[model samples]
Target: MNRTLHRVGAMCAAHPWRTLTAWIIALVAAVVLGGAVGGTPRDDYDVPGTASQAGTELLRERFPGLSGTEARVVVHNPAGGQLDPALLDRVVDALRAVDQVGVAGPAQPSADGDTAIIDVRYTVPVTDLGADAMDQVRAATGAARDAGLQVEYAGQVPEGEPTEGGLGELVGVLVALVILIIAFGSVLAAGLPIVAALVGLGIGSSGILLLAAVTQVSTTSPSAAAMVGLGVGIDYALLLVTRHVEGLRAGLAPQAAAARATATAGRSVLVAGATVLLSLLGLILSGLAAYRTYGFATAIVVATAVAAAVTLVPALCAVCGRRIVRRGRLDVTEPQRPPLTARWAARVGRRPAVWAVLALAVLLLLGAPALTMRTWPQDAGSQPTENTVRRAYDLIAAEFGPGAYAPLVVAVDLAKVPQDSVPALQDRIAAVPGVATVSEPLLSPDATAAVLTVQLEFSPQDERSGELVDQLRAETLPAGAEITGVTAVFVDIADLLAERLWLVVGVVVGLSLLLLTVVFRSILVPVKAALVNLLSVAAAYGVLTMVFQWGWGGQLLGVDHPVPVSTWVPLLLFAVLFGLSMDYEVFLLSRIREEWLATGDPFQSVVRGLAATARTITAAALIMVVVFAGFMTNADIVTKMIGVGLATAVALDATIVRMVLVPASMMLFGRANWWLPGWLDRLLPHLGRRGSAELDDPADAAPATEETASLEPAASR
Candidate 1:
């Protein structure tokens, strides 16, 4: 590890221009390639088992007469539900005149005889109702209202508009920039990392776009790539620049300081990047194409960020070397070490066991709410109340059947049984509970397959919908030999996700353990790290349940009522939070291991290590929390869940896990913390000699007999 760092550092010093030019060329190539192969934006629920995809397939295969599903429409009334006959005629005329509309109807009087509904459907595919489709729907609805009728537009297509916008990304970037500016207190220093982060994001996004041209990557790949890349890239650059500034404060010359910063901080970045990549790659075991694509894209982005951090940032610094230091500070004699970190180390050493238990108890309490977590299947219209589409949808649902907008597709095989058999099949399906109506089946052109449209009594977002799906898949479909359609696809996806969830978990846990083991050179270290990471994850899950599922703080957070968390949220949290939580574990333990190797006294090492790193870890955690919290401002439920989940994880990991639990456990375990079986130690590859020993006394370990005393932050730093 040291040798590689030194070599990279030396190359940077000798050929700064070459390093800078090489990265620029790669960046340009990535952009050009991306432009030639643009990416597709996908809805949040674009996964295979999602209702939209399944319903569309069934419509095409079994219900050919049905042009497409009618997910939503807008009805306009000049004075609420009452409309003049002439104006109503104009509204009907305008609605009928829309070339793309498949269905159009005037308000049908309700039992109360006060309100009316105007139903409309699009000629285009229902699956295409993202931002562009929603815009068109809005335009059509506006035209109807302008014709002098009261208009209330409600449907799934319009409901998803707020989420599809780039609101979350914008918030995250703005928050991060503000925080960085404050942290650095200089425009150049803050802007440098932002520039590096943007370069990483551009490359990562372009790479995903280019890859999508060949492979069927998820439409959500670009957004996920951009979000992940920005956070990680900025983080990597921060570590490097912080180290460089510290070196300057230590009175090292420009070239020498840059070399030391690269050799030390650069290696840490490499290890961190590798760990994050491996953890993300573990998502392939999910067996869901969506997750697989996400895993692949995220891994590519993290790798690119790491590369840019070490190569691009270093090269830039080399060119602008002395300017990085504050003016007239060439001979400043600031301390060479970190003092705030040393204070935390000494505090942890004082009562490790007491703090450890307290921290663990807090996490367990926070995680208690997870037991009540309910799963909500994908619904196109699940957004906050303040959203226009959701409000419009509620208005529509109030007038019509809850399931008036979203319907299911049922398919029957005609070749095996004959067209007459489909009626009986449809009758049987209609008899099932929750089936409000079943349209007659339409046979395919070849007469091999037919489809029926089934509208349920409940809304598509209701839990009853999933129950109905289960009944169709397990009871209805199996009753006949040759029946398959969108419902079947959804059932298949659900089964696949359930069966492979554990495999995904196992892969992530196993790979993460392996990497930690390799990095720390101890079996116990990896096990402890994994346990703490899981605890942090569980706590985050509990918080998610409370906020999203139980409606705690939902209104304040811009969430409307309580909704089941997305199925993908847990898997995403597991992968992302685990990698992020591991960051602190790695940072804290690496320093501890360094002290232990130098002092050879477990007790003293714990004190020294905590004192050396606490402040930096805390600062980093704060920055992450601020950036992640910004995402919560978005009205989208899924994005809000992710934002809250990440912020909670970082906060808990840093304060409870890093500051309290880790110190307490390490101190309580004492010598056992470093003890590894001879065979296992030999089996794992060592990262390198401890940095503390390397920087201090290389030939001698600190005396074990030295009185075990708390080292002050001043002494340690």
Candidate 2:
């Protein structure tokens, strides 16, 4: 063992209670401070500073009071053709009474007649719409319904909120607890990881809130951040505790076992945490404010999990060492011929190349479906189900003219154009394809800009909506000018995101590959890791396409049929699932590497690593799968996509990649598995020695004496 590890191990043996108490105090303080801080939900679009952002900004600036780029509420009743006069008056009164609404009116029906649309706007900045705002909308909708008029509210605000209530978060924690219980078969043992995870989540969330107080972090960031923290936090504790138990089974004194576990398992966790944090940080390359907030918040939570795993977890283990060891009579005796792990290690030493190729082939086959993946544009009430809001929207389209959601606002700077050209520009836009109706240009109060509301023949969420946007940008708008509106803003935002898609993918894949290479110290290993991870992600995307896009099992999944996939969900899921899958890969490979290093045998190493770690990995994966599946119960389309995508990835990664492909390929690889070249080997730094050691001299290797040594406090790396 290294001098630093041994020193820390000794300290853990001496004063376990003191160590545990300090960690408890720190965690409590963090939680208390966190509660005082609150964060904002992030907007999904990339607002301007770039060309796309500038385009979006121009649209918003030109439109002024036009629905602010988000979906707006247009309530009416079709049962009586025109709303009943009394109901119309009541609806108008209700609309005017809505707090924070910028513009409200019981507007006259179109030239065809028989429909009345109330244009209700928000008083606060449209970007401020969040959980609180959604709640207010829900309340207002209910009130409108009570007034004897049908009501429908659809926008980004309502769609973003998780529809499964709090079940997703609750299920995540519960599933983790159940897995830990089965893994350890002890209440205290199982409970410890959950406690650690809770503390980590509390601290991470509080930190985000505090950070948001100083800067802008989106509201959605917190929920996603919390999920990431809980998973990684519990997984880290599981690794540490499992190691400690193994040490005890090796006949070491309780304190000694705990200390050894802290030194070794704790170090691996710190490395893994750093890698996850870095991968999350890659989101900054997205160049979108919303994505940036997600990156920063998720990175902070990952850091917190690392701290809790290394310091808090070890401290607790130290304090409860004897009790934990004595509570269950776990077998720890060392076996003849090193150990089963070592024996299996010897088999892998026989062949390594064949195993590598088989794994690669399987991964490629699974990843094939990603090539055909498509993106869905943002639209009001487009959450894959035909809810009341969507039904109301459809009725409006049918009764009134189409484009009832919101018109594409084109802003013309009349001051910059010749007086004769003003009429011509208006005529040009009115003639554009899909422009069913055009309102006379309303000059801004300043008179510098003229706003023209052009209602299209298609719904705002329809593919034609995007086509209309493109047509305006390409054909309607003349040179040296701008056009802006809800459809235009969304189209521009989508373009910006699409442009940066490759960069985001590159950053995530590049950083992950770099980290894996550093950890494994081999060129081929990192490449293999990246391939397998991508394959798993591709397979998940395929399942999402089948379930969400094709509407297969939509009813069972609590979603409506044939809903387009959310534009942002796939990107978000890619980043999230990539990090998570890498985490599992790292854990499994670290064990395999440990055994391979000891025996210099690839086949034996594969068997030992799988046999020793498979049960734990499977248990952990199931916990995550259950948590993700719980999100499927949400009525929201976006949440459902996230849930199903994540759950499928976890299942496939755990069962196919980890159990089948990884082992089969390793069995084929032999000694070339660890054959890093001399120069590259020299450049890569070795982290530390593996924890378990066989007794070369029985007496010397026998369990340490009753005089327990204590672990030194962990220093931040």
Candidate 3:
């Protein structure tokens, strides 16, 4: 890895303009290809082979008209407190004329006659509803407004989202830029990292768009990539730049400094990026389309960041060259001998057990609530009142039964049961406890299946709703019928996820452990890394449950009611957080191991390694936390939950896990931290950059030998 990075660095530095021109061409080509062939984004939560999935499939195949996205156009008179019947008729007429939405059920006025709700259905999925649908929606709402009534839209496409733009991302980047400037104290030095990161991510975005041609990609994929890519991308470059600056101060020539930095920090980037990629790619084991899609997209972006960091960053370093050095910065030659990070590391080494215990205590306190965390699908009920979807949800729950938001369909196999008993089965289902309303039976074209829609007393997001599903499936299902719907499918999905999540996690964790064990050639290091990351993930979940589910700070976040944690959140969090946290471990441990190998001293090595990487790691963590936190401002509830969860996990992992626990654990472990049995060492692939460098140039080992000798600590000497 080191030799490869050095070669890449040497080539880029030798011909910087060629490297720059190649990157520019690649970026432009990617964008052009992406725009030409990208698939349109869609929102789908289909859990295949589940009862609900079977029912929905049947509906789509047999009755396409009834299977599209549903919307409700609601009108209310605020001043008179009475819906004008004539005005509602006019509004309905305008809506009926709209090409996008087809009125489903008749206009049903509230019992009080003050408000009326019209059921409208779209022929496409909610995510597929384009500008034409919006224009039609505007026309319908305009009609209601003309009649001096309150108008809002709900269901298929939400309202009050004027532009669904990435304003939060822009704000985060701006803040991150400010942070970088302060951290480096040189505009050009700071800007190089950002530029490198953005250029890489730009190509990544285009790549994702092009991938849309071959498969379904969620609209959220780009934003998610942006959030993660920005932080990792910049950090990868920043570490290289930091090392290069140190190299220059060590009296290495310009090109030599860049090459050496690439040989060191660049190797760390490759390993870290590879781990993140593998961990994420392993999510394909989930066998779910959405998870697999997100996993693939993220993996590709991370790969892009790694490639650019190894190649483009070096070229850019050469391009900026001496211009990046300022009078008080490089010329002033700030001493790296006794950085504050090393001092903190020294304190930690003095009482390794004490610091380790304290960090564990904090992790336990934060992670405690995760044991009781409950996950379900989020509905509009949890949204703020100002949101059109929430308003519509509240009105339905108020005027109709709470279950109106989610009705379960009981699909009966009439062939399996006596066909004559269909009516009797419907009657029995309606008589079931907690069933508020049951629709008349609808027979399949062959009369072999009968479907009945049942509205329960509880909303789909309610725990009681899950209980209702369990009751019907276990106790109340009439001989031939199985309940299925949006509510039922989600319940099944949540249950199945709960059942299989451990397997997926085990696969990823096991894979990561094996990879790290081989890379680091130590059993305890991988074990310790996994344990700390797990606790960090747990604490992140606890924070999510507190804010989104436990209702600790709901109001401040603009949510009126506590939402159930999205069922897939924990699984997604586990994969992403584990990989990302491990990236930090890779960075820190690689340096520490490098030092240990050089100095043949464990205690001093830990201190020097910690001091060396701490500032860059902290800055990296800050950027990641802020970027993720910014995503919480999005109106999408799932995105916000993930945003908060990831931000907390990264922050905890970076500080508590990286700074306190890891160093302390290594300090306590001493020489044993690097121990590997002879047989195991022989079996494992050699991961040291020095070995790879020598292999690359059998006759060129002298230069690397000289470089290593120059890097020896003065204290050790």
Best by lDDT: 3
- Number of the top candidate by TM-score? 3
Error of 2 at 652 (Å): 1.5
Rank ordering of all candidates by lDDT, starting from the highest: 3, 1, 2
lDDT of 2 by residue, 415-447 (tens): 576545767777887888788877887765556
Could you arrange the candidates by TM-score from highest to lowest? Answer: 3, 2, 1
* TM-score-best of 1 and 3: 3
Over 1-717, each residue of candidate 1 has an lDDT whose tens digit, in order, gives 765664576567557799877877888999998887655443323345444454455445554444443434445343555445554455566666655666567655544433455656555544444336655555655755566644555543444333553465677677777766666555666666777788887888888877766554654455555566677788878777766666555544445556666677777777778777877887888767678788888888888898888877766666776576545443343478647656666676787777787888999999999888765544445676666656655665665567655566665555455667777878888899898888887666667767677777887667777677777766775333332233334344555676776787788788888887777777777888889999999999999999988888988886667888766677877788888888778777877887787778887777777765665576567767876776677556666788789889999998989888888888888888777788987888887764722432221122222121111122433
> If both were scored by lDDT, which would come out higher, candidate 1 or candidate 2?
1
Name the runs in model 1 displaced over 4 angstroms: 21-25, 43-71, 81-145, 148-188, 216-220, 327-341, 385-392, 416-418, 445-448, 475-478, 481-495, 690-717
Model 3, span 1-717: residue lDDT tens: 677677778788778889999999999998888888766555566778777777666665545555556667777777747776777777777777766564454677888887788877666555555636656766866867877787767764553233253377778777778887888777887887888889989898888777766776665666666667777888788888888777654445556677777888888888788778877787787757777877888877888888888888878888887566563454443465678888899999999999999999999999898887899866678666766788878877887778987688887777676778877777776888888878888876766677788999988798898988888888767555667767897898888888768887798888888888888888899999988988998899889888888899977767777788888688777878888898899889988887887787889999998987888888888888888888877776767787888889989988988899999999999989888899998998886643223434333222434434444334433
The total of clashing pairs for model 3 equals 0
Runs off by more than 4 Å, candidate 2: 1-32, 42-46, 49-52, 59-71, 78-81, 84-101, 106-115, 122-124, 128-144, 156-168, 322-329, 332-366, 384-395, 689-717
* Model 3 steric clash pairs: none
